[model samples]
Target: MSTVKDVSKDSLHSTEKVADTDSSGTSSIHGAEAAVFEKRVWWKLDLSVLGVITMFYLLSWLDRTNLGNARVAGLQKDLKLTNDQYSIALTVTFVPYIIAELPSNLLLKVVGPDRLLPTLLTLWGIVTTLQGVIHNYAGLLACRFFLGLLEGGVLPGLVLYLSLFYPREHLQKRVSAVFASSSLAGAFSGLLAAGIMEMSGKGGRPGWAWIFILEGLFTVIFGVFTFFVLPSSPSRCSLLSEKEKEYVIQRLREDGAISKDDRADAFSWGEVLRAFQLPQVWFSLFIFFFHGTILYSLSYFAPSIIQGLGYTANQAQLMSVPPYAAAFVCTLVLSYIADKYHCRGAVVMFCGTCCVVGFAMFLSSHNHAVQYGSLFLTLSGINTGAPTITTWTANNTAPHVRRASAIAVVCMFTNIGGILSTWLLGSLSAPPRYTKATAVLLAFAVGLTLFAAINTAYLYYQNKKKAEIRATITKEDEPAGLGDRSAWFEYIL
Candidate 1:
């Protein structure tokens, strides 16, 4: 709820110097009041866009994970799938995800997400509905692959879209809200799937098939409506006044790594090369890949895993609800703490530790009650860890094309891990003792903690060096190449 003016005024009064230029072009404070006013205006506009974006993210997730629900309703049996066929279906989705990210993000920039995103949502929804009619693995594979291809760029493209709308400091909490909606989807999937499972007598098709038909239809309908409701950017939004649009643009420039008009030209390969040069991009990819593996394995398979524990099919579907509810609560709580403290890396480390402990609990017991309890911990940790890492990575990038390129690159790597995870957690594998899967996930957790720690340490080192460089040069003598940018551009870690 805090305004940009609130932060700017506070910064002005604080000991840290506010950037300014005197007649000789040396650092000094000049007209702080006008600066604060411009900033406050921008903050309000950004928040409105963020609110709409949150709804888009929530629907995007519901569309993606409904397949998990279908799996529970006899999707496998009806298609006459072999044991490995389900894995093929999952792996096929990632192929499009890995291939389409960069191109789709570029397309969003030109066509505008307002037009492109809804088009994608509707197309994928139709594909999802068609999934219910697949008579064999080949049919299911085609649907799943196209579904992945269609939905592939939405997540990263939206992030790039949002970067054009808000300052870096204000970004994390909003990104967290969008990411947390995934947890909400997990909860909603269980509740909706439970009802659909019980509707077996309503239609000749299995209850699981109806789940896809209805959910996909709903998404397609919403997509048609959202195309009209969503805005292209702050400058085009009717929700803000002309004055407010200028303010939002100014505030983002002040806090962002790049200037507001940096992307005014057509898309260029230079931005892509620049993003690829940053070490953080590679680190982000590795971290996302591991977290993606953990998240998808649990998200897609938890109900089946629960069913394996000697519960009836309906009971298994019903039981998926509570852990996801807990996951949703944990996600919001953890995101709030991260934003409040502005401590991204530490939170990820904590989540990594939680994953380790949770998996250990799963490994130690096969009791239905104990395993159920452990699932809450596992789902919460893995889901929370993924968002925290992604939100952190997003905050580190510059504005415009570089941000889009970095996001596409990160998503490209992470989804490959999704393919790995689907195969790693096998449908044919016996229940209650998926020791191999658990062990693989556990190794990932430890790797995550180690990698996050390394990134954090590297950030600390970079900050120290920047401070040293600032200390060595006075305002008048500062090098002109890097311009007047402050040493305050800290990495999210």
Candidate 2:
């Protein structure tokens, strides 16, 4: 169990590995430590962890967003719900979600991912399954709200978990890759839901019930698999070679601190307050709120939107697959670039710009093809930029008390956007098109673009200052010093 300070020291060690050595009274500087071998080791660990986290997240999303499919398959009719009542169901979930977010994230740091995440994922899956059995709107509301409570930790937990395994520079791509699974879930949900809905008359269950039952069951099964398979951190990963573990530790040390231990003293109210005070936290939260507003509103209503274009329910669900697929491709490509360039801010800005164009097109277009293309654009923006922002913000924080607190606070604020989106695109906004929802999404896209720009500028300013400080301090003083010298190296807007 290395202290965060030890981890910090390791990072400094990584930067100095290519030190000057005296040979025959001549100075010779060593080259970087085997970049190819180190990178191969990194990639191996990345693939293993990425595979486990991606599948875990895919189930997480399918359980939550599949409700959109259920809605179209007679859930509202069975509950005798008005549009407002459905929005209320969505809104109620966010209440517990917001309340639980920070607590849950802090708990993840306390208990560690090995025990906490899989347990919560399994519990939420069971809760999701209960929605199928609910006979009334009250019951559905209860299930959804509890589901949110169980799920509140998932995104932030994963963000915090990945921080333990990767460097800040490497994190953006990994995050983007993992988040692309959500787009895959959207596509898969559509495909799977279409099949399940087709089984409407079988087993004496409604199509909506079948959607919940099948998806929920799959989630539980996957959760159990994650428990056995997911690595707690690079230090404990069975698949990594000893050299790889050293490499991982060194790379992480080179970047910033992340914990491998269960940080028991991780929950501090003062640190939590400080997290909230940071402009980076608030900026990302605000952007995520609007980002979620656009993302969930479109994801939940996408099939319905296509159905509004005169297609049947099944046809609409089928049509939903393409945009998600396109988003997946674009997100992965952008993630690779972001990681390669070590420029998360620039990548996110470009993605946000794309979202603006997509949302604007959706708002104004009458042609179905153009509208469908806009779906791709909007998703590319939210899906591509979201993971970058999340990974970027998370990696910028220190480990333990502050990191857990900040992740939770940011996530809590972000989920509020989900609640707001539900209300913004009430069922009443459908049919000829939810003009109100589209317009709001466009406005938010512009806001997010500007926010991303400001965030980029702040990061660049801080980076510039760090460079100046490094230039002032010679390499010899670097190892024993720099504690207060780069103290204001913050990610803020």
Candidate 3:
């Protein structure tokens, strides 16, 4: 098999554009040789790039969702917080988290992910550890707000980060891999919280406090380590030889859109505005908003829901593990299928259906075991659909800054749902089941199902109308003001 080193520099840097501008941009670089070299590059990235992104996401999710675990571990009781106050604490985190995401993503290219991602992780880790030591509601709100501010950039930053290395078609699975960490985060928090609870009376702190301290400290340490190891970009990754680096850069050029090295284009307010103009961006925002309502509810309330199952606090912590565990696996599988089929909406809608069915069961059934069982489906669906929504938006938006703005906007809507869930649904009494909250989440699920199909059809139309225009376009025309709307590009259908 031909290797990356064997490819001539002339072929690697070929000026000739491929006849088919829709795919890779390299005209002379094709067939078994290029294919073999590309796989070698991907395998390296799977280790150095995809692996780190996934690990960082895992740490982030643990810190973000551990609030649910801590709640059951007695955070509220120790703080002497009322339901409204506790909800306020939850709601505060998302406020800064939502508002700052756009600017955060825009800064990713300027600041670079290697520095920006790890810096955010370390700061948030410090904040998370502070959650362990707080004595009053004011302290709690401070920690939560800063935590959100630091963390707001992470998910969108990471999603934007992936587009730097991989082609658009390969995005759904990679995005899924990172988000699956959130499901794993849910499971790990429960198991870790269960163990941390054993340290309850030790160090004169409760189990909930220990949960934050230990998890946060570990994150700080890992964040420091990641800074030295995480590669900056395909262009700067030290693992690749010069030829391999060129191959990697050439790969992105072939896929179209501003490759990492070519991102020197001056940022434009007009390009940023375009992200808001696209109908698909609105569809993606709504999908994220509606889908996030149920997901955030599950992340924040799963332990409480399990506790409502007549289980002890410890048992509730342990039981919350299963639904997230199921979600972790299903997220990987479903997104892989979605990427492979290039039919992302089918998988998204199917997952949304899982949520609708799960929520329907929650509202209709009075049985505790059945309600608990429905959580597996509920969480799995919610987690499964998240990455698809992200990739759908990222795939269509272009040039670095615009995609950044679009992704950040999508994240804002996700947290808007979080605020709604925390303030409205979570404040309700849980005695006999939260019939009202379940009904509301069910409506959001139905909305997700309908809109995934709508966005899919709409993208199909956009691609069809653009196909003929695309056929007449060349590589030189791509950098014009049209951005991703440049005929050199087509929306993923």
Candidate 4:
């Protein structure tokens, strides 16, 4: 039997070996030297990568959800769209969106995110800008479908991309930074919509036209900038010194981070299938699916919901700002806490409970103040829950290809909720009060809370079982592979 001291010494020696190994599996940098480089350079690397990706996601989300703002700014009135036709337009976006996610993520691996993401952004920007010129319902439908097709890969692609740069324990805060951009975009879209709608009849175009044109143009410009600024991978980054790059790679290896394999490895269908076999993947899918239904419905309908409460269009747009802003702040704080504690399941459950409570309040109340206050709870809950689930899923998956496939699968299923939300919230049958929609939202929230609780318990059970297995293993019997399935690679609960 190995003594505790012997196990501790072996662990220290193993960690040292991990820090020194180079791409060819020979010792290069001293462990202390690599540690110093990491301590000094990690922040600079994180800032550059996180800043650009956050901005990209912000614009992507703004273009994707800005239709809600446009609707309140007279898109339906200008296009002579009935409520069902408008809902159909929204639903159409998710068809191509869902279909494109897995393929685009696979392509992202083959081509590289720096190349593929920017190209997708540019094409979607053009499509979004063209939405401004649509004369009738069919044109709107066509633009929205293509827009979804082009935009589908971005969020999932970025999630996979970030996994390359950061370790599991450090991921949620960074992922939250990207996800929070959506909330910030939500807030900015409201304020921008109010200002842009003031340009009604400018250049012989309606205010909603200006909203799409101007925002889409902004996305195009930023997409161009991103092509130049974003680095493809830590090993290939021009911004880092050779030593810094090596240190980054070494730290990731020690942390059992994703994609430790050389990028030259052939695409493995076996690995892709293995990703689908993980229970975590399906759990993550359900979590995102339920949360997304509530999240998208709120994003698409909040302004109208507020307007139905007796505010003018501009007032409703402005009022929409607070809920999103509240969500933005809460997402960042909750993600930071989750990462610090290494407790994603707990954070997700808490957020789901908030969603359940918030929606229940909205369903039961008639007072505008109480209802509006409930929006804060709903947005904050759903927004925080999203990144927690995403990061948790990403953290558990490994090898670049498998992570890509898992993320795509998770995102593909989640967007199905986007389609469902359009009809559920945008139905002509539930105007003014939208009582039916609110009730459905409440049911989804309850489901989310239940799902999260069950997931947490299962994770705990898995962890306990893994602990028992680890206790029986001697150093000589340890697995050679890295990542979550390895005997030493415990899942972050």
Candidate 5:
């Protein structure tokens, strides 16, 4: 078996002294060798792991948000549904959606993401296709509910899955890759919806029906493809040899020094209980919820909002493409900056500011050009939160089980934000400026600013305490089930 390199006696002595007060984990491997090996492993994972996850996320986003395109293309009129009922359908999906995430994440501990995530997409894709043929509002609601039930856990599951492979410092961009793909998917959803909607009446169905049918089937094809390809863990990746895999796993374990608890890696209710006891998880939930309101509002309503700007449905579909494209680019750029600088909270605050500015502009404007421009700013703000927040929380939470559970807990509340957004934007707001909707979303943008700052300050204080604790406590005195509470554990600010 491959092993970590040994430190020189003098070097080991120095590190031991430093470790008594330092919060960062110490590595036995030589720095140069560690860097080279880590670089190679990461390069391979970027190609194999990150790309596949991004593709899955794109497909997921397409399946979830295409309803916006469909709505623009006459789903509401076709189903003979009133606005409140349509909003209820949106809300209904999130109910099961929110309810499913925690258990789904906990279940991820049992099944592994490679096995569980694809099953979710494949099943949801089938449900999505069935939506194309639905005769009435009730069928739409049922399909939506099941879609929620299936799709709810995919994000948190994917987040937890990623936390397994990456060290905390290197996690944001990889996680961003998953969330950023949604923007690309939004763009694709518009372009694809534009093309697919043309198939309307060709098979005795509306263009909107074709949108659902084609996107859903495509999702199924990709989900099945992913099922065969995605590796369960970094050690399982085919790109690395057995030695490299062991080295990779060992280094990751070292990086997560909060794993003082023997039971931490094991799947157990005790770990779940430990996750519930974390204060940071609760703080993260508030930010996730605030961000989710903007996220869901923007993704699910942009096409309709554009159409309401006096553009035709087709025009709205095409117009919806640019802001999301910009958001995708912005998400990547900011993710890089955040990861490079360890500035996740700062980046999140910046994105939230973008939303505030964007919404302020949108609310002030009657001009379609100005409103459209505002979308670029607003959506750039909206789509970037998932990566930053997930990484931030994952960075602080440790051991396999609690991190997984923390991710699920915060993500559950995030979707709950989506439920509220549907009502705020969908039920109460309407065409020609959506004043109430924009205002509420603007308020959420401001809230993101407040909470991101507070959380950052709180984590900074906690990190200081962890450092002090490390100074006072020797390894032999450390207790089990410590997880993130481990004295050696440091929160990323």
Candidate 6:
């Protein structure tokens, strides 16, 4: 095994040779030594990078989804809110949320993730904590809006950050880990809410209030810790030695990773416009839109759904836990299989099929046992498919700013589904049998299945075209620069 020092020296010596642009502008590697070095350092990178981002996402989801838990803990009753008003509170968040994602991602490119992500986390934590103190519908709406505004950048920002470190083939599992953290947070939020509800009158605060306060505090603490813990990029990560860092960067180069020059360039409106031109970006937006409908509906309404099954409020909270826990496990497994086989499209379509079946079962069955069992499939399927779609978009896009814009645009459109979900599921008139809402969600699930199939077929066609081009083009005839347009850059299906 080559030592870190040995790898670093070899990498430095090879830089000139690697930088040479033969029409493709991609580096060729001296194989086995590079492979050995990568294997040696990847585990450390995964632990430090993926671990911290996953934690941040966990806390973000915990704070965001706790509103559902709070609603069950008597938030609506105390605020004297009708179901429509409560729905408005949820819907208002996405106003700022959608407007902020694109600009925030652009800002992230300027300030860097280490600084930007923690700052967003801390601000959202403050907003989340303030939700505990809101007395009226107006106050609650204000807090929710700010919470969404502050949180808008997190998912897209983290996706872009991960893209900087991992190759296209390796991204699905890391993205899944971050998403599984969200599922784990959903499960944990239920248990935590159940416990916090026990503090209903403690310190002159209601149980729902306590849930926000405690979870927000936890987020703030973790956000502060992340600022010190997360390195901005591979080259800046202090946890690794110089040689390890060299190996990481070298491997990325060999794999045709986006260059630092592309990442560090000044933000351009041209890149943003180019992102919109890509068909994959539009397909991703539609895919995630339906995905958001299912995901946010569950995150915000699962407890209510469980309560509708005639469980007690507390029992409903506990029942919510199992679906999310199942989702956490299934998401990890599904993502692992997708990455291992390099079959993102197939895995996504499979997960979408599960969602469709789950929703169909929910609509057709009146038996509580059958409905409850369906919750597991619904949560697991949507959770698994959401990250897969996100990773798919991120993987196919190129250059840092364009990727950022593409993700932000997809997230922006997708979250409109969030707003729709709140209105659809939070209807005051639709009580125990929200039959209408379930039917709508079922339609969304069917839409997801259709979108996944279409997107997969499109990607297959593009890959076939790229393969043909690669066969005809000489090295000197290949498209240059770091973008995905290179003749050799095939889309991952």
TM-scores of the models, in the given order?
0.89, 0.88, 0.92, 0.91, 0.93, 0.92
Give the runs in model 3 whose Cα sits over 4 Å from its true position.
Answer: 1-34, 259-264, 471-479
lDDT of 4 at 239: 71
Task: Determine which window of 10 residues in candidate 6 has minimal summed lDDT.
Answer: 11-20
Top candidate (TM-score) = 5
lDDT value, residue 173 of candidate 4: 85
Per-residue alpha-carbon lDDT of candidate 5 for residues 218-297, written as tens digits (9 for 90 to 100) = 88898899888999987789998765676556556766722524455878778788887877777788899999989999
Error of 5 at 118 (Å): 1.5
| Better structure of 1 and 2 per lDDT | 2
Q: How accurate is candidate 1 locally (lDDT)?
A: 0.75
Question: Where is model 4 more than 4 Å wrong at Cα?
Answer: 1-39, 259-266, 474-483
| lDDT, candidate 2, 192-293, per-residue tens | 988888878787778899888878887888888878888877878988876467657756654545443334235667666666666666777777777777
By summed lDDT, which 10 consecutive residues of candidate 2 come out lowest? 1-10
lDDT of 2 at 393: 77
Question: Any residue pairs clashing in model 1, and if so which?
Answer: 42-247, 42-248
lDDT of 3 by residue, 60-130 (tens): 88888788788888988888998899899999999999987988988887888999999999899999999
Winner of 3 and 4 under lDDT? 3
Q: What lDDT score belongs to each candidate, Candidate 1 first?
A: 0.75, 0.75, 0.83, 0.83, 0.83, 0.83
Q: Model 6, 225: alpha-carbon shift in Å?
A: 1.3
